[model samples]
Target: MLLANVPITVINRTYSSEHKLISFADTNTLLEICDKFQRPFLHFWTTEQPTLILGINDRHLPNLAAGLKGLAVNHYDYFLRNSGGLAVISDPKVLNVSLFIPTATHNYSIDQAYQIVADLIQTIFPSLTIAVHEIANSYCPGKFDLSVNGQKIAGIAQRRTQRALVLMLYMSIAGDQDGRSDTVAQFYEQGDAYRQDRWHFPKVDKATMTTLANLVSLDISVEAVEDQITTALAAQENAIDLSSAPELLRSAQFINEQATQLKKIQLRNNQLPIV
Candidate 1:
């Protein structure tokens, strides 16, 4: 396990449209670092386009064929994530933060992992009235979703290995959050089986979800939000300089080893190949 005072490696990054899979693969790379070297990592990434990332359960959605066709028509590329949670939308306005750390216990509580992120968000936006609870009819419904004034702004998900833990969150920073919500709702509607499927998907209502800009009523750009987050992190903990860290370089090299399987997982889940 990492020493209590070890510096947390912070990576503030954004990716090209084609690097979506590489983005997730990077987190797994950090997970391996935690497992192998007992190091901890923090990552924040922004996507350039509106991408639909579905969860494992999405493969069995009843009208999946229709949904995939609709995704194609809407010009939104899709992929299956290595973590849990239903479908989620990402764009230039959204920020995805993940924490990869070592775990000492065999069974880490899911809520405990989520609370770590929720607490960090509270630290970042101390003035905002943040709430953590499931917002029904919201995309990626979950018990630890973060919201302000009853409208969801972030969703939390977690994945764990025997000795490593990864907690992931997607926060909408700007843009028409309602339109994004509507988009996911439409995907589910197209993919619905007249409620015949054993599993229940969320009934997304745009009003029940919102962006940080909407919540604060400020024209907060995604870049500004990213700056604030990284600044806050730098102030709160020791920041590791990734450029000069040899161990981190090796950790990134590890990602190359896992790339083939990461690419194939989505295809096996019936997702479209990234062109």
Candidate 2:
């Protein structure tokens, strides 16, 4: 199951400040209806405002209230993502790419899904020596964290259902990498004041992370990165317009399903006890 042989549907759009959560919900919605298209869907998006995205485990923090208060005090808006991975920064400087693949015909293993995105990233930046491993003291550190010379640049996470899978990558293209790390590290400090959850929360060190702009001489802006990704997948491009595809975004089933997903997100976030 080579990526080049699979059809790709690219949806490039931006989410406003208030509607940022919709971006995630849309991905969930697409994954639910992915079988109807019988192809992979690539969604490229960025948020208008900076947001702190928490993972499922973050909800279980012993001092979750202090964590939420710290975020509010710092003027940060956050939500628990349906996907896995600890808190990650999502702002205009970051470029998020989500690939939703239908598995009705071919089943994809966990490593296969991660490899697909890693391969695409390598293709986009062929000049750099990108390493795939966990970067010590980096936020959201994982086995699939993409790094350059020990400095983490991007992290990948995935959410899988029986019929489909959505692989998400948050690439730090051009921004203050250290400041982003600091923000997350501080959140952990406040969330786990006693450091009781040391093993669960990462001890982020700003030195362990970096942005793509600092690594390559190429134009590493978010827009440029998006263009590079598009070119990398050009062979499998099967562009679709949502306005014309009723079965995808306009059909009754899609509409109801998306609404339901959105409601679930709202309930999850709203039900969290605030200190």
Candidate 3:
């Protein structure tokens, strides 16, 4: 089903420089909202700090310590995400979106969830010829990587609970795409210098990645893209501002549950040796 067919609560969030980790906690809280309220959510968020988010497998790299040290030496903050996919960069210039849909009524297939985000992206940038395929040697390469003229500009990943699914996407809207890719490449190079691990990490190539600004003639800002997205979804009559519902935020149960989820996220991140 198209996204327009579902009623979604829209949330726009910005995190402080030191609180980028809270973004993950917020997502977890939204999952709880999905379970309790049985409502879909479309969350858009950005962080003031540049972060190198590693996936579950990254913690098992043969020389993970050396890789994390490299990131620190380069003045980059790194964390392990409780999700699948290799390392990817998230900064002020990158736009992160999550679509949380409850599956209690409709069992959306994996491909269907991916296609929903792809369709939304296509609606946002109609001028570009978007392709859905793995861009070899690109950071966080996946079958659903959204590319323009063979260079990846965005990637999609999925996380599901018992009753809801969240499709997470990170789009390189405006920034030094090459620098971001190079950082990830170097991390993998240093982390698996010996190449002895059974699981192969990507050998990221900077040329295989491009930002949305580079692919289009228009000047792109995160806010502009966000406005366009909200406008598009609103036109379809599928969006409701989550902030308008003050009762949800003021609920004691919500406050306690969100705090618990945040603590869990903190614990998970703290368990990583890099911390």
Give the best candidate by TM-score: 3
Writing each residue's lDDT as its tens digit, candidate 3 over 1-275 gives 43433467777888875776778877888888886677778888887777799888787788888898988888788876767778899889999998888888778899988988898889989998899999979988899999988999999999888888899999999988999998999999888844775776888889999998887744889888887877777766665565643566567866787788778777878877652
Q: Candidate 3 regions off by >4 Å?
A: 1-7, 245-250
Worst 10-residue lDDT window, candidate 2 = 238-247
lDDT of 2: 0.80
TM-score ranking of the models: 3, 2, 1
Q: Residues 1-275, candidate 2: write the lDDT tens digits.
A: 24423556677768886887788888888887675665667788888878888887788777788888887787777777777668899989999998887777778889988988898899888899999999968988899999999999999988887878888999999877887888888888887834673547788999999998898854668888877777767744534333333345667887888899998888887867765
Worst 10 residues of 1 by lDDT: 266-275
Estimate the TM-score of every prediction.
0.87, 0.90, 0.92
lDDT by residue for model 1 over 56-111, one digit each (tens)? 77767777878877887887877777766789998888889887767754446878
Clashing pairs in 3: none
Local error of candidate 3 at 254, Å? Answer: 3.2
Of 2 and 3, the candidate ahead on lDDT is 3
| Ordering by lDDT | 3, 2, 1
TM-score of 3: 0.92
